[model samples]
Structures are given as structure tokens and as C-alpha cells.
Target: MRYAICFTPTPSDPLSQVAANWLGRNVFSGEMVEPPAIRGIGIHEIAFHTAVPRRYGFHGVLKAPFHLAPDVSETQLLRDMMRFSGSFQPFRIPRIEVARLHNYFSLVPSVPCEYMHYLASAVVQHFDRFRAPLSEAEIERSDPDGLSAAQFANLHRWGNPYVMDEFRFHMPVTGPVNLVDMPRIEQALRNVFEPVLAEPVTVANIALMIEEGTGGPFRVHSLHPMGKVSARKIA
Candidate 1:
């Protein structure tokens, strides 16, 4: 499976737990949620139910999926990736309301912070060691969804149609909605999560998350804090 270097929120964070619980309570089937490895975790519940089922369990996608070489163990890669990221310290993410394309909702920063862009770029560049870029056949997989011509072209060129100029940072919430339903979802979210949104959530750390071969539940591998500490580690 491919990997990415993303700053996934720590599992202990209240917000992270909230997001996960929301998924377990509202999305995944009870059977899926019962597994000990995945049960009692918010990300697992969330990752399992959303449109991307295997994506169930992470708030970050640092590296897109890639096959690991026979010699590389996930633990070894994680320890190295963590050391690489930890050397970097931590940073912050702004808070804002964001509209989502998935028939539902989300929250994101009003402005794309320079650091956020840097982090995304860093993941792609630094993690390129394992990536094999999306193949043409992979792009064709989306044909069932009937993408627009421009979108199709982007997938072939960029692996993900939503990156670069098309990128928008968001934390998922209720699934998609029409303008009419937005008000309700927004109010509900605000009522329950006002504390989370009252101020910006600092994205001080990036976490390495892994999915088992093919599509599997995304699990936390390691976390690296951002900032001077991180920089010092790299130095």
C-alpha cells in the first residue's frame, strides 16, 4: 500500500475522538465497529463508513498509497518517517467553515496558511521515495463516477484530481447536502462542536498512518510534532 506523510490529529485529542465517535455512532455497521483493533476508536468508525471505506480511521493522508519494497517493514518505515517528521516540530491550522462536495459537510481554515501548503508539498516531495504515481488505468476507475473532462485530465496528470490549484483543506463532517440542508448541518455541528471551532485548532503534529495491504483500516503509526523542535531534529 502507498503511504503519505500527513499531520493526523492524535487519537487522544477530544476533537479526534469526537470525529471518530460520530462515525461509529452514525456511519459504520455494528459488526464493523465490534473489532477490538478498530472498536472504541473514532477514526476507525469514521474511516469505515464514509464514501472511502478503507480510508476509515485517519484525518490525514500524508502519502497516497504505494507498495512497500520487500525489505521494508511498516514498523521500520514508521520509525524512520517519525524520526524525519519529529525532527520538524509542530505548527497550527486555522479554523473556518468549509463547504464539501460529498453530499455533506466539513470544517477548514478560511485561509490556506503558508505552512499548510508547505506541509502538503513536503509530504509529496519527501515521500516521493515510495510513490509510483497513479496509472492511467487507475484514472479510468473513476469513469464509473463520470468525471468531467477537466477532472479526468487532472487525475491522469496529478494522481489526485483535487490537489494543487484544486486543493482545499477540510475535516469531514456529515455527508454531503444541498444548500437547503446546509443550515441544519451547520447549526447541528456548531451546537455540538462550538468549543472546537471557537478558536483555531493548532496542527502542531503530523502522524504517519497506515492501511493494510490493498484497502484496510487506516491506523496510527507514529506522530511528529512540528516547529523548531522538528527543525532541530532534521538538523
Candidate 2:
């Protein structure tokens, strides 16, 4: 099974709840809740269904898609990731209501937060063992965002080109927006996710997501809460 560690927000985390509702069962076909995507709901649903996996919907991706390496043992990788993650204090991100990325709609942090950066960096830093080098097909899926020669070279080295400086934190709401429907879709998203937008984003856990099949609407495999640390007394 292909797997990745992610930050899956819970219902108590309103933003996540709303995003979840918006995506519903349209994202997946397993134990996940929400109804299936049926025709005539909207154009976005039709198009989204065409490109999306049955188990995918909602939440931001802290870690890009990576497969567990056959040669690398999973037990060792989790232990190393936990050890590496032990030092950081649990922190929160500012509220993110609405934002746009290229042709897609997204939820973005209202302000920059160290937790976001640290989390992203951690994924890049230690989870290196799980990821396979990005293939041409993966890059092709990116299309216009397709890697240049420099990016292709970086993929060989980093397994994902959008690491470090290239990383931009945003939770995608759609594939690419059609200008004519932009306003209607935006409002629909706003209405569906309003409760989440009104609150601050609490960062307490990291989720492990998996893809059981070739096509995905990926869903949570497991979750690891970032435990709070008591401040060490100075010697």
C-alpha cells in the first residue's frame, strides 16, 4: 500500500470539518463518511470526479505523495521520524479563511507560523526514506507546473521538486477553476466552510494517509498527535 504522513484536521478543528463536509464521500469509497458523488450536482463535481481518486477529499498535504521504499524498513523509518520530531514545541497556525492558487481555490494561513514551516521541514528532513523519486508521469500530472530541467534534476535528488523554497502552504479546494463559475463556486465553498474559517487552526496531530489502489481520493490511515512537552528547567 502506498502511504504518506499528513496533517488531517479533526471536526473540533472547524476548518477541517468544513473542508471535510465540502469533500464528503466524493473523495473516497471505504470506511469514510459522506455521500457519493452523483451527477447533476455541479460541473465541478463532474470534473473533480474525473480526476480525483475515490478516497481523496479535504485536508492539507503536509507531506507530498511518497511510497514506502521496499528496501527501507517501515519500523525504522517511524522510529527515526519520531526521534527527529521530539524536540519541537507544539504550536498553532493562524486562521485561514480563503485563498486562490493558480486556477484552484484553497485555504491558506492568514499569517506565517513557525509550526507550519517546522512541520514541512520535518517531512522533508526525515521522511526521505519513504519517498520514491518522482516519475515523468507524476510531473506530467502537474502539467503547466511541470518541472523544468532544473526541477527534473531536483526530483532525482529530492524525490519531490516542490520542497524547501518551492513549498507553498495551501489546502486545495478544486482542480482548476473555470472563470465563469468562479464566483458561484467560491461562494459555495465559503458557505460550506464558514465555521472553519472563523477559527484558529490548532496543530496537535499528524496523520498517516494511504492509497490502496492505483487511483485515489486518499484517506487517513492513522494519526499521531504531537504531544505537548513540559519545559525543561534550566540547570
- 174-216: candidate 1 lDDT, tens digit per residue: 5545677566555655654556565566677776655546765
| Best-fitting candidate, scored by lDDT | 2
The lDDT for every candidate, in the order shown, is 0.55, 0.62
- Per-residue lDDT tens digits for candidate 2, residues 51-73, read 34224556567677777777786
TM-score per prediction, in order, is 0.69, 0.79
Model 1: lDDT equals 0.55
Cα shift from native, residue 57, model 2 (Å): 2.9
